[model samples]
Target: MNRIQRVQKELERANADYLITGTTSNMYYLIGFSEEQMERPLLLFITRDDYFLLVPKLYEEQLKQFPLIVYRDGEDPYSKLNLKENSNVLIDDTTFSLFTIEILNRFKPGRIGRASRILGKLRQVKDDEELEKMEKGVKKAEQLILEFVSNIKENMTECQIERKLKSFLIEEAGNISFDPIVTSGPNSSMPHLRCSDKKVKRGEAIVIDYGIKHDGYSTDTTRVFSLGKPNDPLILEIVEIVKTANEEAEKHVREGMRAKEIDYFAREVITNKGYGDYFIHRTGHGIGIDVHEDPYISPDNDDVIEQNMVFTIEPGIYLPGKFGIRIEDEVVVKKGYGKTLNMLQKELYII
Candidate 1:
């Protein structure tokens, strides 16, 4: 179903009259527009009877393109017009600041709900268009990784690699989904390590994690490579274990499966290999307009897997003061199984 149909269905379920506020992701999902006035707060009022967009006076012309009610700041449209009371209003929790909340409460005090929580749950499952965009994103990210690894030189600092990756991604994809992670040697052991001036040495494993954005959709992926020759057999072994676990978990993923179960399937593989403790963080998380979404693949998540849901299946083992290896891939849940979006080779690369 299209986004409007999905949202109308949600309105029926909630028995809400209107949903208000201007969150970029939610607004893009509801109406096929990402206004340039995103820096200034805007409000999208969606009701069963009407659709209204409230923007700053400066964005009046842009709002006119859409066929809906437009409310500008300089004009007191609400006062001039009659707004029905007791109209169930859904507000974006993040966009509605404390001051805005007070104003909204004074004006429309009836049944107020939060759109962030509701829409978050709805966005967990990807539709055909969303999946297509994410697939493109993943392909671009994989290509960037390949290019980055091919040009890697000895004694290159972590910052140098990160800068190169960012430059390539911006030139090719327009923008990166998030900050690229580049760590070499012992620094790779930190899952969220920041890039530094530490130069990479021969026979050391370097971890590169990054994602690309296309049409507001994102795909996250990570890969580990060894410089020169393979200096640590344990690093290679861990990579293989994580890769196998990721593959095995994808096999069991289908509609109706619990998210936590998928995480356990991958975790069990690493545990059986006696490297469970080294594996930190969740197996993966839902990906879409935002890098992280709902229906996350973690021990604490109980959300069930559904058809059209897209997420990453990344498993890693980090041995502190040594090296870390992570293999990640984006997957789309289907009827019988999950389909991998990333085509990059999973075998440990020796650069």
Candidate 2:
């Protein structure tokens, strides 16, 4: 079923009067309408029998052709919703703030529920159209990384290389999925290290984990670049271990497998090799409109890996005050295994 039909089913099952959401990813997912997040609230109030896309008057002219509700400044949006007392209302709690909640309270719905999970649950398995857009994003990102790396120099600062990343990406797409992570040398040891002016040099590990958003879908990848042969024996050994861990997980991923087991598939490899303590984060997270979404792959998640569910498998070994190595790939679960979205060579890039 399409997104709208799927959500109508959720509303029916929950006996919800309506599902009201702001225009972020969720709104787009529901109706394919894209708008900027603004100080003024833009809501899509959806009920089983009605579709009211409410927007501020400022945008009404552009969207006037479409039959939707429009409210101008100095108006309470709650009035437009035509909400009833004791009505079961579903909303996106993550995007709606307390002020918005207070406005929602004016209508006195009997119970207010969160719509994030219901939406995510329906989106876990990508449709063919989504897969196509995602793959296009993947190809663009891989090309951007490879082309950028070809010009990477030993003495260039991390921030120096970072500045040019956006221009390169915008040439082929819209907003980036996330801020590109560019860490080098000792800084690479910090898993969530922010990009800085630290200059890369020979024998230092440079970790580049980044992604781009294309056609409402996203692409994420991480590739470690060695300015030259990384001289640190420990860094060399750990990178190989992480690579092996990533590969093992990919080979074993299939539909009907528990999400946590996939985590174990990678975690066990690192643990057996004596670096389990060093592998600090969850094996991976689900990827879609948002870089991090549902069906998270971790030791605690029991959600079964489903066909068309795409996620990243990134395993990293970080040694404090030294260096780190991470190998990540985005893949789609299949009948017996998974297929990686990224096809770039995963071998260590000895620049």
Best by TM-score: 2
lDDT tens per residue, model 1, 3-97: 65666678878888766656566887778676533444566777665566755666677767755445556665454334567677677655636
Off by over 4 Å in 1: 35-39, 67-89, 93-113
Candidate 2, residue 107: the lDDT equals 76
Global CA lDDT computed for model 1? 0.80
**Each candidate: how many clashes?**
0, 0
- Colliding residue pairs in candidate 2: none
Q: Write out the backbone clash pairs for model 1.
A: none
Best by lDDT: 2
Q: What's model 2's overall lDDT? A: 0.83
lDDT string for model 2 (1-351, tens) is 766677878898889987877877887787777776776778777777666777888878877755677888999765776667788888875565753566455877888888865788887788888888988889988988888787788778888777677666766567788888888888988989888888889988889998999888878899898887887877778878999999999889988999999999999999999989999999999999989888899999999888899999999998888888899999988666899888987767987
Candidate lDDT values, in order: 0.80, 0.83
